[model samples]
Target chain A: MSVLDEVLSANEAYAASFDKGGLALPPARGFAILTCMDARLDPAKYAGLSEGDAHVIRNAGGRASDDAIRSLVISYKLLGTSEWFVIHHTDCGMEFFTDEVITGLLANSLETAALGDDGFYDVGTGPGSDHGQHIDWLTISDQTQAVVDDVVRIKEHPLVPPRIPVHGFLYDVRTGRLIEVPVPSDESAA
Target chain B: MSVLDEVLSANEAYAASFDKGGLALPPARGFAILTCMDARLDPAKYAGLSEGDAHVIRNAGGRASDDAIRSLVISYKLLGTSEWFVIHHTDCGMEFFTDEVITGLLANSLETAALGDDGFYDVGTGPGSDHGQHIDWLTISDQTQAVVDDVVRIKEHPLVPPRIPVHGFLYDVRTGRLIEVPVPSDESAA
Candidate 1:
């Protein structure tokens, strides 16, 4: 069976015992989490969120990209969330390659790249686009710094309110732990 | 306790028993899922995903915004995901308002809005920005259509490989079921 079929069948079991249908549109916990799309980091599990608990915005590196900020803005401005967390994880795929490297790979071909001991190398032939060159890819060199940068970016965004406290953390995929990344005291104070 | 403190406490328990430290960086399931930031939808639970199972990109409405496409591109181009799913859920907060309404609310005040019988209304005083006016917000008028649109957008993206199949599904928030949103046969065939 396809992964889609498998998940659909799983959903059947999930729905069989589903009872939390009346959750309010607004997050009951009054918070939002911005994190990576990495499959290993389950925001609901790590963050202890139940249905109707919080909004979770995720992307490549969980960076504070414009789209992510837009989601955060809506999460608070419209959905009544008062707090936010920006989480990036250890062993994140984003940290494995830079924008130039990924773009170079994409420019070669749109097929999957193989990761050897050294790093990723393209395996496909022909039919590639330079479109990836235009994207930042939000690659991460430092996990803690990436989390801090995202937190600061979200905290400093024009659309984000000063009242909301944004926290930064790194989730350890191995141990399933969230380690806080401290923003500068002055920055947090300001 | 603050939500942060509470979640951290919960994390201790999750970490204590965590034994999946050996999972690889790339998703083992060889697929990706783009879904909404809705608090009610647990993509892991609904999709039956374990650690390192699949890439899951999420945003306000799970709409295929450029950033989402960027993540999906990286998911396939770099990580080897062969299939993708665009899963938007029922009763999403994005369906509660239009782009204009959200930007209008943001323009009035950057504080949290209240949801009453009429819909969202700003209750905070002063200091708002028109920055939101520039954002797309990607609000949903119809859930199934949004899923179909996202799937089509991902499939037709310049960076996405044509060989990868993108599936569209609407997750019923009430039942925890994923109902397939059939793409027009020609669209999928193309």
Candidate 2:
């Protein structure tokens, strides 16, 4: 179903409120590195990347999107990514944002939480809840498997071939230390 | 192969650059959103979402990653996301940054050029050359479908579910419009 335009307009009005607080961030250069634009992420520090070194591609949690893949494909075929790094950090916002809120917002925006799952809104979920303070959060071990699986999947893509190496990493946003996930490396050994 | 320590250090410094930026970008509320942080692709304007809404994920192309999926699982079961959206946009930097820059930068620092499929980097091809400007460049239709496929893959996983709704969209950075890719509206329809 089409997203509610009125809801979007309202969101725009509110999000505009946020622009006043924004850092006026600029785009990265060279190869884009997909990452969380999260202030805590600090992909450069954690991933050991630098500006003008690699394009720091960021989103919510740094999930690879079709465009990311398309960029990756171009990077590999025309550019040079024989491998990739999947970095997901601890206490990520992606962990907390739920469908209920989205549905609720949509319902509230549309003035009737009556829509089913088909109504996917194309608006920002806002800055989301403040999740950076939970120092006691779990290490997110399953997150390791997620990174490994992505590497494997990306490697096996019909367009990418089977040999590409994808490394899985769990970065500690607070500490800036990267812990390698075992699945990809283990599977590569096998 | 492990990521370079210097790279990590540089990234740390870059992240630190934001210390004065002052915007306290909050963690995603429930699910991490993976959308382009492209200045033009405003989530509030397009996705009909807002602050405190959901995890406003961002990246170059909003591609799904293993880490992203892992986080999604946590969001769904632990946090509460029954839905997901993958948004990418036209005129993305992902299309321009070359692989040579990424690989070379990772291999060395910002100065050294990484070799390519043919070898000899300095002359054959330089770093950061994969991406460029397209006159009408931006917004390929398949960009949306790729995200849908990613969502479908995530939903079918034992970690996710088959009933969840997944959406794919391409944002026209110039016109401020969101176009629906030709993915099945409902999985049942497929």
Q: Chain A only: list TM-scores of all candidates.
A: 0.95, 0.57
lDDT of 1 by residue, B101-131 (tens): 8778778788777877765475567687888
User: Which ten-residue region of model 1 chain A has the weakest summed lDDT?
Assistant: A117-126
Off by over 4 Å in 2: A1-190, B1-32, B37-50, B93-141, B185-190
Report the C-alpha lDDT of model 2 over B98-169, residue by residue, as the tens digit. 444344433332232344456444433322322222211133345555557665665555444554555666
Which candidate gets the maximum DockQ versus the true structure? 1
Residue A139 in model 1: lDDT: 91
In model 1, which residue pairs have backbone atoms overlapping below 3 Å?
A: none
- For this target, which candidate reaches the highest TM-score against the unseen true structure? 1
Residue lDDT tens for model 2, A1-190: 3333443454455445443222212322333345444444544444544322444444445555444454455444434444466677665654544445443343333111222346443333332322222212222235556566555655554345344555566666555556666664455532
DockQ of 1: 0.83
Off by over 4 Å in 1: none
